[model samples]
Target: MQRYFVPKEQFDESGVRITGEDARHIRRVMRMNVADTIICANNKGDAFLCKIKAFEDQSVIAGIESVLTSESELPVRITIAQGIPKGDKFDTIVQKGTECGAAAFIPFHSERTVSVWQKEKSEKKRLRLQRIAKEASEQTHRLLIPEVEPLMTLDQLLIFSERFTCKAVAYEETAKAGVQSGLPSLLRNMKAGNSLIMVIGPEGGLSPNEAERLKQSGFLLCGLGPRILRTETAALYLLSCASYHFELLQREVDR
Candidate 1:
């Protein structure tokens, strides 16, 4: 069955109203007609098996045959503060991060970050990234579309640390300290329902001063592994590790 996203306000006891572009997609793109069965998610974590009841001039009405809660979100909320990389890396980050179950994404301008975010260009890029996140969320069957915040400087991100319960930053130098000192351990130690903030640096990775500053500000410094990953690669690595550590493997451990 085809799947589509429906707004929360459009859902009720009667049915869901699919209109505008979505209606066009159903009527034209997907070519779904009246009496056709499809799935619709309201972004509030509710999935409904819907059957097309009426097709109006500009809208389509679908009767909810059944509803189920979306269970794809990670147990712990993870917010990734990634150092904006050059080229199409940011788009890839947004798409993959959403699929990996990141609750939110922040593009940071770290000391070693090569990409500069001017106001107009930054907005343009953020919008594009935001669209990618939305599409990825829908494709992955995620209830919430992780937000991509505007670009922030290193200082700004450090100051924003008060927003999360647990904060971790990926530092390559820290791996040499010990094996338990990696991202997997940090995520493993996180309790359910905890909100986490992970910081990933740019191409060259976090500078010594930046790492020191983060440590001084109460951020837990963790390593990925012995092999150093690129700026774009680091966020996905941490996200996948986080999902496995907090959502899958951890749950089995608890059982």
Candidate 2:
């Protein structure tokens, strides 16, 4: 069944009311009708199998049939803090990162960042990214949508990331020096349910001074791998490694 994320307030004891874009998509785009079954996930990450009860006044009311259970989320919460890159790359980052099980995203202004969010259109861009995150979450059957934060300066990102259990910067220099233990060692030290914030540089990568500042703020300057990866791919790589260590490896241990 197709899935849609409904606002927490829209969900009641019996069912949920889907409104706005989702309702339009259900009624007009998907052409779904009454009695059609769909999966509805609330903001709190609870999902239910629902049957459409009615389409009224730009809304689709669905009655809860049963609770739906799935273990699709990452055990560790990973947030991607990316230096602003050019064009539609950020969109790809948010969409793919959500699919890879990222819990949040932060677009930051690094010293070497070439693209800046213009003041007049910044909110529009942020909303677009938020929407992308939501759509990606629903498509991946993720109960909670990844949060796309407002564009932040380097200082703000550091402060915002303070709540995470661990923070790391994807420094290419470590990768070039044939250092391989950085990322793996960090993973081995991490426990399930920990939150991680990964800072990735934009196209030209972070300046040495910026990287050093992050290190001073207790962020690990870890290399991703032997080869360099584009800014867009770095977060996905980290998330995949985490899934391997925390999910895939643990599955074997359990078996």
Position 213, candidate 1: lDDT: 90
Which residue runs does candidate 2 get wrong by more than 4 Å?
none
Name the TM-score of candidate 1: 0.91
Assess every candidate by TM-score. Answer: 0.91, 0.97
* Candidate 2 lDDT: 0.90
User: What is the C-alpha lDDT profile of model 1 across 1-255, one tens digit per residue?
Assistant: 677778899998979999887799889989887899988888777788999999989999999998767668988888989987888888888899899998889998887777788877988888888889888987888877888888888888978878798988888777656554556657667777889898888888889999999899899988887766777887788778777776677778888
| lDDT value, candidate 1, whole model | 0.83
Give all candidates' CA lDDT scores.
0.83, 0.90
In candidate 2, how many Å is residue 188 off?
Answer: 2.2
Candidate 2 lDDT tens digits, 1-255: 799999889998998999998999999889998999999998586899999999899999999999988878888889999999988999999999999889999989888888888878888999999999999999999989998888899999889989999999999988878888488888887787888899999999999999999999999999998898899999888888888887788878988
